[model samples]
Target: MTTFAPPAGPVTGALPLPVRRRPGFSLEGPFYTSAEIFAEDIDRVFSSQWIFAGTEAEIPRTGDYLTVTFGHQSVIVIRDGDDVRAMHNVCRHRGTRLLDETCGTVGNIVCGYHKWTYRTNGELMFAPAQPPNFDKTCFALRSVHVRSLDGLIFICLAADPPADIDTVAGLVSPYLAPHGLKNAKVAARSEIVEHGNWKLVMENNRECYHCDNHPELICTFFPTYGYEPDEIPPNLLPAYDRFLAAENDLHAKCDAAGLPYEAIEELDGRDVGFRIQRESLDGAGESFSADGSAVCRRSLGGFTDKRLGRLSMHVQPNFWSHVLSDHAVVFSVLPLTVSTTVVRTTWLVDAEAEEGIDYDLDELTTVWNHTNEQDGEIVARAQLGVSSPAYEPGPYAPSEYQVEKFCSWYIDAMNAGEPRPEPAGRSTGESG
Candidate 1:
């Protein structure tokens, strides 16, 4: 196995990142092609903010854990007693890396280099040949700030994470709670390494302007996602009409069930940017299937209504999800390099629901599986284009407003965070 490691410092580039950008336009090539900017993104954007890690249902039992990796850092998110906790996945002794596997249950975190052991709660349990002066408390694994909004897990590596996470969570949890993700089980998961900058992957997801590229997705998915009522194109007018009718029905059902269906979009100008709404799917208005019918037979959260539509949410930097009555699909993005990214998509369903009986494995996963592949190709082409010297930033249509917001949020994040210092007086300039 290749032991993963990050670069010592930012790789130098010819052009520095611009502080300001014109509204409704794509970022300049350097933002996508520069390794220096990518390093800054890893530090100022990923490290200092509350990132969507995983779901609580992932580690439902004590000792269960998941590992999240991004750039230089690896974090272990584990269930400790009744609480979920996160810690740096590094052995306190000798700085040996711990928990190499992507995920597995462990009675205790043990360092292979030494016999240093830690409890599931991260307390140092045992260490051979320790000096009398060595305090076990001091040797405990360094903890990361962790919080869960109902079931979605988030972690912050910073000493003080954004305080707005609580505010965002409070506003989002009620809409997410009814899906019962905390009680759900991961039905399926798909991970892909896309040849694109992390920003491109997120920017692609922020709007449906390019959704026409996803044929399988556009079947039930309303391509009118980011379009304003007046700004909607003539070609998509029929879809807009259908969307309006379905939204009315969805709102009525939500009201009857006492669920929140209104849109809450605060995608920018916040420490923890996000957007959420319970919107109607086309056709049967149930799920992402070709006919808009649920792939899972079992309903989530004991919802008697299978046509509850989809509760979709997007968090800045690296996460988005859609919760339907039948199942919930969650996605998280992580950068591997300046021009490569990893996208993980997980499907969750009722804990008691059995596979093959309550849901067909293929049907549960097919729509998004195809959509993700299609998106990967698009991002790869985009990466290639942006890397070319002839490439120039392009204008974004009005329907691409969310994409503009995402870029705005990214710029704000990069500007607001303190710059990371270069290590050992290393120059962050072009070094052949």
Candidate 2:
């Protein structure tokens, strides 16, 4: 029989969360710098939540798969005919890792350490020299709970993943289905390792307070994001006026197209916090380019107008995406260490769109590529500041409400004995 370490002890054998998070301020420095806290984070939060894996677009074929690794866990997300499945990367026999490449198409999963093989659905297919007495049925690859919401794949390592996802899918699918992300194809993919704690990276994405540093993104994305209309600052009032006008036009267009444009923000007080909306871009009101124009000539979701604005969605702990008339961009964040995080960015366009004829690869990808680089530098500096002994939690501004909400959700998950997920059905606020 195989055995594991730390039978019933804490996985990290670490003390309980070292400090209480102050309301409306950044987390204490140790939360971002301590290995113990990082380990606790993995065992409690990441291991127990519904984490967004890559989109189905990355694995369009029946046998395609992608591997996701964070901390000590690795999962293989594969497409098996009509459904997507998630399983531990470890082989059932001798616990050998079954697949090593980041992603690829595989007829079956075969371990390199030993030749034990499993079918695409993770059923043990062969055990090189096992006796007839050995029960292959007992050794199927351990399965992880997985859900694909309109093509965006998410997996939970926990035995009972948050049931809120069913409700979340129901709420967000109308906003996402029009983009047809499940049937789309990947245009470009990029991965970056940021020099910061995973929380810091998430905080940076929750608000636009520092968007002034993202020149390329700010041109199309409103810098006034997250601010209440009445709280708009004097310096940003002109931009706010432009946003209002664009929103009016966007609403009419959406109505005519039978699309939903209202916002549904549920970023806290639940296990599966999230937000979704279809809002207008600043300039051409199309895509994430300098002029907000459509980068791909071939329209997505059968839309010929090329001006459907942006359908943005954010799911707690680590996932966000924006789907436009021309394409969709998805991001997944995973913790690497106490002071490091890795982010994967994917761009999806119509499967029929030609690289050179219907889209210019550089133009389609330049905005987000540069924006991610700039954010990486910003997160690195934030990490450096948090590591210093003089660091202290600071207050959040009114415009940074979502950052506070994100922190609230993070703390609740970290401190949970059994997370209270939002029930299977929610009508208002998407509440628990």
Give each model's clash number: 0, 0
Residues 101-137 of candidate 1 have per-residue lDDT tens digits of 7677999998899879999888998999988888898
The Cα error of candidate 2 at residue 90, in Å, is: 1.0
| RMSD of each predicted structure | 5.8, 8.0
State the number of backbone clashes in model 2: 0
> How far is 162's C-alpha from truth in model 2 (Å)?
1.2
Q: Which pairs of residues have clashing backbones in candidate 1? A: none
TM-score of 1: 0.93
Give the per-residue Cα lDDT of candidate 1 at 269: 96
Ten contiguous residues with the weakest lDDT in model 2? 1-10
Against the true structure, candidate 1 has what lDDT?
0.87
Model 1 poorest 10 in a row by lDDT: 1-10
